[model samples]
Target: MSPLELHTRALELAAGVIGTVQPEQLVLPTPCSGWDLRRLLEHMVGQQRGFAAAARGAAPDPALFRDVPVHGDPAGAFRRSAEELTAAFTSASAGAAEPRLRLPEIRDGEPFRLRHAIGFQLLDTLVHTWDVAAALGVPAGTAAAVDRDEPLAAALLDAAGLVPAGPADRAPGRAFRERHEAADGAGPFDRALALLGRDPAWAPPAR
Candidate 1:
């Protein structure tokens, strides 16, 4: 699948997970270390907006990159942001030999190819979707979320070949952590999650 198609699938999966979140579940701890459900949602929304802006060849609005205020309906707010992000990527894909995208957070504001940028976003969305699901106690294969992530993971692996190694390659804040050791018989999806720094067996803290 094309990067855009993969991104759309990733967003759809994320939206499904977000829609299932109960308001009281917002404070639940996720596998993202210090982030709770609310903070994770905020970061997801922010990245959607930030990447959308980057697709337009404009600097991401500093405010949008900050914590998103999920006042009233968090799901509604996220849906709007996802829609805007999809539109921006679609617009950038039109009539462009290659997209000239800039992400200020990476490589000191260097530009990246559109495919690579979309791959980064795809990886983020898929992994975070699992984070939210696991926090909510959604079973591993529930709604085929893991199934959806597998191909997206493969796509990222393919896209990675296109990115040249640079200083950021050796940077401390790499996109994924060292791959965790999985138990015997772990499936591809679980292995992929581990590769991306997520523990497949992670669950929310007991009350």
Candidate 2:
């Protein structure tokens, strides 16, 4: 996909997540351990800013933003951050090499190219939507989690290859199996969710 298309989808996905944050639900628990909804929102806001800075070819400006938890609707703040992220991505690489993109957040040891960055960003945004939906006692659509879209799925699978390979055999309490046991065969989202220790059949939790 073009940077423009990826940027547009990212904005939509971010907005979708932001739309899930309800005022009373700020303190709710989520899939990520040790982070209540508030902390998760704060992290997402900060992370988007961090990536925006990277997209603009700058190191994160720690001096600019405080880490103190802010009170109020997380979705509003998150949406603003999303706007910044879209602008950064579109501006940085819009007409340049979409093929050489790299986001080193997951595994910086080995450099991945453009397809990896786009795919990773899309996948990450999609999962985080589920996280927010869980916190808000809402259901994130299953469609976002499953992509039969061949281009996007192929992109994600390609980026996934860049993850450092583990041993071939599953160890005790392994996070994933070489094959998925889902009745209809695994989807790209299934592989991603499993990689992050989520059961595909489980609904996002509310706590």
Candidate 3:
């Protein structure tokens, strides 16, 4: 599938998990260190808004990357943001050939290829969906609402090749942790998550 299609699938999966979140569950810890379900959702929404802005060639603003308040309805907020993001990418895809958009959230002065940027979002969306599922006590093998998509996982693993597995991965505020080894016999999705520094075995701490 194209990066845009992959990204849309990831967003749809994320929406499924977000839709199941109860108000009381917002405080549950997620795989993202120091982030609860609420904070993770907030970050997801903020990231979508930021990327949507970038797709439209908007000026970079720090606020664009900062977490937006969920204001009680995480699912509604995420759905609206996802719609905006998908629309932005759809519109941008029709414009000038091979436009490289500035991604201030990733780097203050760097422009990334449109396809590569969408790939980045795809990677993030998949991992974040897993993060939310883990927080909700879902087992590793069942991260998505639908049946597992091995091909999608493989595609994400390939897209993850774009990430630098260097000291930069350890930088403060970096989206991923340093690359680490995946367990022996891990499947494509688990391997992909591990490559991005997420332990497929990660679970919420015992309450």
Q: Which candidate ranks first by TM-score, i.e. highest?
A: 3
How does model 2 score by TM-score? 0.71
The parts of candidate 3 lying over 4 Å away from their true place are 139-147
- Report lDDT per candidate: 0.74, 0.58, 0.80
Each model's TM-score? 0.83, 0.71, 0.91
**Which candidate, 1 or 2, has the higher TM-score?**
1
Q: Kindly list the per-residue Cα lDDT of model 3 for residues 104-163, writing each as its tens digit.
A: 756563888889888888777778888888998874634433236765776688777777
Q: Taking the tens digit of each residue's C-alpha lDDT, what string does model 2 give over 1-207?
A: 663475456557557667656677777777666678787778677767766666665533443233335478676787787788778776766555643433444444234454455555665566666676665555345335337455555555554444434554333343233433444666776666655545555544533
What 10-residue stretch in candidate 2 is worst by lDDT? 168-177
Off by over 4 Å in 2: 59-70, 95-104, 108-115, 140-161, 165-186, 201-207
By lDDT, the better pick of 1 and 3 is: 3
Candidate 1 residue runs with Cα over 4 Å from true position: 60-64, 148-150, 156-176, 182-185
As for candidate 3, its clashing pairs are none
**Superposition TM-score, candidate 3 onto the true structure:** 0.91
TM-score of 1: 0.83
